[model samples]
Target: MLNTQIKYIDYISKVNDEIEKTNLPDKVIEKFQLKETIEAIEKVELLVPVIGAFSAGKSSLLNSFLGDKKLPEKITPETALATELRYSEDEHIEAVGANSDITTFSIDDIEEIKDRAKDFKYLRMYLKNENIKNIEPLILVDMPGFESPLDLHNQAIMEYINRGVHYIVLSSVEDGTITKSMRRQLENIQAYERGFSFFLSKTNLKPKEEVEEIKQQVQDQLEDYFDITNEIGLVDDNGGESLQRVLSKIDPEQLIKTIFLEDLKDNYFSIKEAINTSISASGKTKEENNRAIQQLQKALDETLQKKNNLIEETKSRYSDIRINAIVEAVSMDLSNSIEEIVSVGMSGDSNALSETILEIAKSSLIVNVKDSMNDISGEIVNDFSTGLSNLNSVMADFTISENWIAGIAETTKKMITGASNKLNTIVSERKKVQNNNEDIDKTYKAVTSVLAITTEVVNPIVEVAIVFLPEILSFVFAAIQENKQKEKIRTTILTTTIPSLKRNLRAKLPEMFNAQVNELISQIGEQFEEAIENKQASIENAQKEREEENRNMEQIIQTYKKADKAITTLANNTLYKE
Candidate 1:
């Protein structure tokens, strides 16, 4: 997997270098970058960094993994640094800096030692656990709160992530969804490294129902935005209650293990299959058999080009029919909605009148827009279907004469084999004379013998093949002529029809709507904007209400944070206890 990632990285780097020279599209470059990142992650061993907003129970989740309450103080109770846990027999914890300076500290003294100068840039503690020993070696790095007020603290965590294996994103239920800053950090990590997971921490802090709702919402949002289909794990401090619910949905440890093992197995099998196929194909002599293959490849390319031209021609012919249908549908819907709105406004009902008027206008605009879109979609589908049908018809005419080609290929093979055998026989007959370094006359005779056989055996076969060449040449010319005619028809239709249809559809709709439709559209636009502004005001009011709710929720956040800190502190103290 690592090898594959390295190859992918190198390939992408070379491609990017070329793209820079060529000034390729930004979207193409971005696509390459995304592919490179995903490939890189597939190779590296990832350490899931459980990160979140300050006091979001990131430490508590780490404690749960360790199966101990003794981790380290979270938030202000402990130095704002990342602490990683891995299996080790040694009783000491090692703190290493980005500068490569190492500091040894008793885990118990971590909280008491307030010397910021001596504080390590990164900390790793070895815990004596049978479970850790049995699983693939992984160190869980507990990141400081991503949104920590202290820049140095955040920078320290960021540095740790740059050097670390993978990330496990964490968030709290009461804290709302993961913040935008946290997401940006994750994106930054993804830019360089591939390994990361998301964890909704402190599920126990909220009710099961609320936690589930938050989890679904967060998962849906992440999947929609990041295109990640993996189940997002949720962590709870209380005996893994909510964590287990998430675990039931997705086992993080199992997933991590599978990431490497399954990928390695898949790559190994693929390489093996490729090697076997190459060896099997190589048995056929290139000199004897490749000419026919080349001819077939060339024929296929020509056929494809012809098919493409036919497809384009058909698309041009049918495109307008589909676009007109959709445009008519949209115009009708918009006109009806506008008429209804005008009728309602004429009635002069003022109570809820403003809301109703705005709603009607917005609805009319949406219907009209959707109808236009529908027409475009219908045109696209019709074009695609017509194109495919025409391509099939062209392909049908370009019949691949496999049997005739195969016979010629086999004849060429026989000629090469016969010549080779005659040469071998002559070489064998001259061996004794050549070995003695004597009998110059015999050696000359042997050389002449092989040359004569080659001229006689190979030349006649070539001559025979050459005789048939005129027929093949005639056919190739005929095919080229047919292809040219097809191209001319294709170009004529596309140039004359498709663009005109699009323009016509665009023009017909406004005419169909007339002056009343125009007035209604203008009214709808104004009402829709007014509705949006009203919605924004309502949302602001809701936000105020949410802030009040958060005041009540702050206690829960604090409770979870305290519980997390207590558990981590206990675990750290226990592990380092003399």
Candidate 2:
């Protein structure tokens, strides 16, 4: 029943009130980055990516929504890419490159854009049209049809499904029903647990009676295919209903669950875990408390030692594995492009050769090194998972690493009495559904933030390879003879250029990888430290109360109980349920 993102903001505000109950200086709110999470929730926009089969008028439908032939395409763009239409007073297109480079294009540079389409990651077109402004947070992604060529286009679609709250899929009315290709796309959407609407475009090209029959047949097929009885929103381009109007009908609670829910639940569980730890530590005698504190201190000490070892291991991994992979990939790819490299080498354009080598290095890094970093990230989590076992049950286990697996396991034993009871009521239904549907792709807080920063591991490593090019390849072009030049050029590249690239990479890359790995582990380990400190704070606070004979332990315990009850009731509401 919650119809706006305001419900989520209000929910967070209420949770903050509970977080304030404990007198710990560093609260659960700061540990989980809830303030930033709320801001991201407020700025959440529903991306409606429209996909369909060839000539399904996917682009036409979106440009029509603009009420102008704004997006230039032959119904669908020729390339396997997306053109994202967003609202901005200052209108322009930013061509995002695979290497995260941006090139700005004029709003009217349609031909120029088409010429350079293959070079772009996606085109982010900012528009100031009235209808676009009216939709507010709903941005439309114009996607390629089912039969589009190239792997990057498919990758783009796959990435979009992760962030898209829902999809608006279209097929032509003339086709009369869904095609096999479209059915596959819908299956994929279902696999990702995303909801989509069906729109039959170009209805004006068919008879009204025939359009009605096709719409009905498509609706029935979708229900039968997806094995669900929920009615899909079907619209036509001939004007009976508008796409914007149907998009407005999207259930806001579903949107919240899809976009902001994982982050919200993260903070919820984090606070619950902290409270439980405090309660568990409450009844311990002074000697028991000292023993526990000593144990905690021992773990913290072990963490510092582990961090130094991990940093050293990260440096070795990059030098041994990541750098070697790049060297081999760049060398192997260039070996095949001997003729092209020879051309650039003979033309005396050291800059062209540098550019060619840089492209190959970038490709190699994206395909190879990025994944290796994720593996290292997984190792970091697994290494610390055991050491921080007491505090991680609710928070650390689920901390974001692309390759790590998160499971609730037996860590629920850490919860205190009342919080455990409340968790039981929600876990049987709500948690299971959310984990199955939405939490599969989630990355928790600073872990993900650090990863985002480290994803640029490619640029510094590969771009650094460029500087060595001019220095190393400068000698090959000094003397050119037609008879021996080609072989000399190839040998020089395979011998001199590549080794220089590898040497410089090995020299500079381990440090880069170390910094990233350190930041990631530290970000995760800092949370562990805070949780330990909060528990210690709770134990000490209770001691002070007993010494003064003024503080009521039952009252403090009741505050936590009340917080658990409120959180449980909120989870039981319609927004958190399936």
Top candidate by lDDT? 2
lDDT of 1 by residue, 1-578 (tens): 33434443443344334334422224223322334234434434435455666677866765665567656644462366666667777755678865657878776766643345235566777778654454433445667664432333434543554345456677777766755445555654543334566777767677889888888888887877677777777676752344334333434344433343333332222222222222222233343223323433444454345434434443344334534554455334334444342333334432222222222222233333333433333333333233233323222212222232232222222222221222223344446447777544321111121112222322232233223323422332343345534444333223432233234445543333232222222222222222222222322322333345334434433433343344334423422333
lDDT of 2 by residue, 1-578 (tens): 23546777777777677667765335334555555556666656667788877678776677677888887657334554687888889999888887768999889987787777778768788998888777667778888765554234444564475557688888888787876446656765664456887777887787888888887898889888987554545455632246877777876556656555654665566566666655555555666666666666776677677766766666565446766675577667667666767776777765556655655554555545545655655556556666566543332222332211132211211221011121122222333456768554222322333223333465566556645666876656564444437778878777877777767767777677667666666655554555455555555655554455667777876776777778767755624665
Off by over 4 Å in 1: 1-46, 113-118, 149-151, 193-195, 239-578
Q: What lDDT does candidate 2 reach at residue 228?
A: 56
lDDT of each: 0.42, 0.61
- RMSD (Å) per prediction: 33.5, 11.9
Question: Backbone clash tally for model 2?
Answer: 0
Best by TM-score: 2
